[model samples]
Target: MATVTLKVEGMSCNHCKEAVEGSLKKLPGVKSAVVDLDAKTATVTYEEGAVSVDQMKKAVEDQGYDVV
Candidate 1:
């Protein structure tokens, strides 16, 4: 398993946190997703071969957020 912490922007509330966390957790091989509104970051744990950083960024962008 591998873990990545991405700095994300435009998250202002719990709903935004939930949205991001939910989206990431829905992806295949993602073991966990934790979104921190105060920190503006998303920490994701997944299988190395099952997912990629680019895919994670795309998933967040698809939800209307910016991974910076």
Candidate 2:
């Protein structure tokens, strides 16, 4: 497993947090995803080789958030 902390933008509320977290969680090999609205970051734990940071970024962006 591998973990990554991604700086995110446009997250302002619990809904935004849930949106980002939910999107990340839906990805294959994603073990966990937590979004901090105050910090504007998403910490994701995923199986290495099953997913990539680029794929994670796209997942977040597909939900209307920016992974910076």
Candidate 3:
């Protein structure tokens, strides 16, 4: 598995973290996702060949957060 730590912006509350986590969890091959509102980041564990980091970025962006 590959783990990605993404810097995210525009998240202000627990709901924002939840939104980010939920979005990533929906992707295929995503094993887990943790969103830290304090740090404004998300760490996702996924099957390497099943998903790409670019796709993960797009997934977060689709949920209205900036993925950096």
Top candidate, metric lDDT: 1
Error in Å for residue 61 of model 2:
0.6
The pairs that clash in candidate 1 are none
Per-candidate RMSD vs. true structure? 0.5, 0.6, 0.6
Q: lDDT of model 1 at residue 43?
A: 100
lDDT for position 7 in model 2: 96
Query: Which scores higher on lDDT, 1 or 3?
Result: 1
Q: What would the TM-scores of all predictions be?
A: 0.97, 0.96, 0.95
State the lDDT of candidate 1 residue by residue for 1-68, as single tens digits: 99999999999999999999999998999999999888899999999989899999999999999999
Q: After superposition, how far is residue 15 of candidate 2 from its true place, in Å?
A: 0.6
- Pairs that collide in candidate 3 are none
Error of 2 at 58 (Å): 0.3
Which portions of model 2 show Cα errors greater than 4 Å?
none
| lDDT per residue (tens digit) for residues 1-68 in model 2 | 99999999999899989999999999999999998888899999999999999999999999898878
Native-referenced Cα lDDT, model 1: 0.94
Model 1 residue 53 CA deviation in Å: 0.8
Summing lDDT over every window of 10 consecutive residues in candidate 1, give the lowest-scoring window: 47-56
